[model samples]
Target: MSPKASTRVARGIITFLFIYLATPIVVTMIYSFSTSWVKTILPNGLTLKWYSELVASPEFMAVLLRSFSLGLLTTLIAMACFLPVVFYANVYNPQVKSHLRFITVLPFTIPGIILVTGLIQLYAELPIPKIIILVLAISLLSLPLTYQALDNAFIGRDFRAMFEQALVLGDSPFKAFVKVIIPNIRAGVLVAMLLTFTSAFGEYVLTNLLLGGNFETLKIYMYRLMRSNGQASSVLTTIYFIFLAFISLILILIMQHYSAPHKSTKEGAKK
Candidate 1:
């Protein structure tokens, strides 16, 4: 095709994609506000009753809180466990580097179904809160993400040199890590934490299979009831979408901050 035709085709494709992706969100927003929307081209009337009902439901609140806690706790533990292990392997234990790749890839290698089956079989006999099991399982999936983030943080910097320099300057090894390494990698760490929390919050299958109704989360709660109450479900969805979008914007800002130093270094080299 000629240039004009090619440009028009590209624009048409892009426009179609935008509509394709946004159609559900627009339809749902309309449905969420509608008093009655079934069997119609447009909603019969608009009202805030669904949202009001959701806000008043203590069950909904509790489920949301549980989901929030799961996300927060999972991120905390993933960060704690991955950071030091990565630091030690990079600086003190070079041989462990080869093993780390195999460990990180374990989550992706195993299917969730098989992993959960083994977990239930093993832990079904053990007496512990199923939520804890779910947390650990979810954290396994998050390990690679946080690991790569920390790895990127250490890529251009010398972990051993950084620590030894701090030692010469009269700082403990731990203090050097906290005072120097952390500030340098802070953005990557935040990105990893936020991504973990987001992934855990949206996770459903493993959670549903293991914790189920015993420890209600937003995902489980929605699965059990959303189909029965379309209006309410849409409202909850819109709320969650807004919340996730807000968090995503924060992640984007952190990522920009993280890349800034690298970008400046590249520009200086080019100069």
Candidate 2:
């Protein structure tokens, strides 16, 4: 085929794929707003009642708060545990990255059920709060994503030289990292944090098993709704989809914002 025809065919396929994937989500969103969608070609009526009812519930607010707290705490813990280690691995000792690669297969190697069972066995009788244990476990699960994102941020940059220069300029190592490296990799850090938070926020298995549905995060609440109320559950699912879309939009904006300067600099060099 001619190059132009080949490109046109690829574009056609991509458009079809996009529509194929988006159709269900679009239908779900419509259903969330429908008064009654059962046994019909279309909704009987469109109403905001479902969304309003969901948003107005105290339980909804509580569940949202719980999920947000879990997401935030997990993100913080993941950042603290992985950021410096990732920095050292990428900048000073690339060899450490080889050992760390094992982390990428963590979920496959140790499934959530197995991990939760082990946690229960070890910490079930401990004096410490299970919430804390839960947070730590989620953080551990998120490390592979955190590590990879932060590791990628170090690419195409002379971080060792940057760090050494900062050190030579009389800044302490922590201060230098905070002042220098963090700004440079802010985009990646934001992406990593968002991914970590999203993972923890929607986490069902660990939260459900560990807290025994007593914690009632968003996912657990959604599960409960799913069993009892299809309309409400659809509303919740639509909201979750919106939240994910928002996160994705933020990530795309961050990438574009950060890349613009590099693109301009490269163009200037080429000129």
Candidate 3:
């Protein structure tokens, strides 16, 4: 085939893939606006009644708040607990890097249901809420994603040199971490937080099994609506998608802003 013909074929494939991926989200957005979509190829009309009702729902409000709060807490807790550990593994002990990577990835090897079952069995006698248990489980599951992001940042450079330079300049360990390291790894840290928060936010299997009806998250709320009211569920999904998109955009902008100085200077030096 001619080069132009091959290019046309590639463009067609790309267009097809984009539409294939976006079709579900587009369909859901349309359905969310439908006034009455039953037995129709196209919605008869469009209205915001479903969304308005959803917004006014106290149960949904509670679920939304809980999901956001839980996701944020998961991010915060993972960063606090994992950053130092990952830094140590990557920068301090080369021998532990392989072992640490294996440990972080263990969560992905186990089926979520099995994992949840194990947690329930182990914590059956604990006096804590199932929600806390679910949070811990989700955080564990997100470990690989969070750790990999930070580890990639650490691997591309010599953090020990930066640390020693700070010490030589009379900065304390904490001051060195704050002044030199944190800013350098800001993008990686933000990426980790975004990944972990989104992962925990959307996790349903573990949430369903561990908490059941005792603690309701947005996922649980959506599942309930899905059983009773499909249209309401569609609206809820649209709202959830919008919320995720908005937060992702905000996080990406912050990451880019922090990354700008280092990215530009590094690229310039490379050239």
Candidate 4:
């Protein structure tokens, strides 16, 4: 095929792919605005009643708060607990770095239900509270995602150069990590937080199985209300989607801002 023809075909394909992916999301957003329930094709009217009702409901508010709290806690804990160790593995321990990767990924090999079941069984025999166990389980499940993000960021890094520079400047490894490495991997850390938070926010199987109706998350609330076909459930789902979208938007903005400085610095050095 001619170059012009091939370019036109590729553009067509790209447009079609975007539309295909966006169709469902667009439909859901429209449905969230619908005023009528059980419509065959689409609602005849659009109104904000559903959204207002959702916001006014105490149950939904509490559940959303809980979900946010848990997700944030999980993200923070995962970052704190994993960063130093993984950074050390990559920078210092050449032999064990490969083994550590496998160990981190092992949890992903098990089915979520089975993992949750095992956690519940183990928790029953231990002295810790169920809530703590549930949090730990969720954090464990989230580690692989964080590890992958941070590990990729750590790759192509010049640890030796960074350390030597820091030493010449009379800075410690910890200080260098804080000053240089952290800024460089801001994008990866944002990705890790987004992934971990989203996963923890939507994790119904593990939370439901572990808590057994004793605690309710946003996902659990949505699941329980799903069969009723209530407007409240739809509104709740819409709110959750909105929250997730906002987070993604913020992460994107952070990546843009965090990346711009580094690019500017590189160009300055070149000049």
Give the best candidate by lDDT: 2
Best by TM-score: 2
lDDT of 2 at 194: 92
Q: Tally clashing residue pairs in candidate 2.
A: 0
Per-residue lDDT over 1-271 for candidate 1, one digit per residue giving the tens place of the 0 to 100 score: 9999999999999999999999999888888999998788988999999999999999999999989999999999898889899889888997998899889989988888898899989999889777889999999888888788777777777878888899999998889989988877787788888889988987887887786678888887776668689888888888888889998999888777557756647756988
Ranking by TM-score: 2, 1, 3, 4
Cα distance off (Å), candidate 3, residue 8: 1.8
Candidate 4 per-residue lDDT, tens place, 118-192, comes to 877777887998888888888889989888887877777687578668878988878888887787677788888
Give the Å error, residue 228, model 2: 1.5
Mind giving the per-residue lDDT tens digits that candidate 3 earns over 1-271? 9999999999999999999989999988999899888888999999999989999989888988888888998888899999999877876787998898899989989998899889888999989777788888888999999988889778567898998899999999989998888877887888899899998887788888887787788998898999998789999998889978987897778767655656757766988
Model 4 scores what on Cα lDDT? 0.81
- Which candidate, 3 or 4, would have the higher lDDT against the true structure? 3
Once superposed on the true structure, which residue ranges of model 3 sit more than 4 Å away at CA?
247-271
Q: Model 1 off-target regions past 4 Å? A: 93-95, 261-271
Q: Give the range of the ten consecutive residues with the poorest summed lDDT in model 3.
A: 255-264
Q: TM-scores of the models, in the given order?
A: 0.90, 0.91, 0.90, 0.84
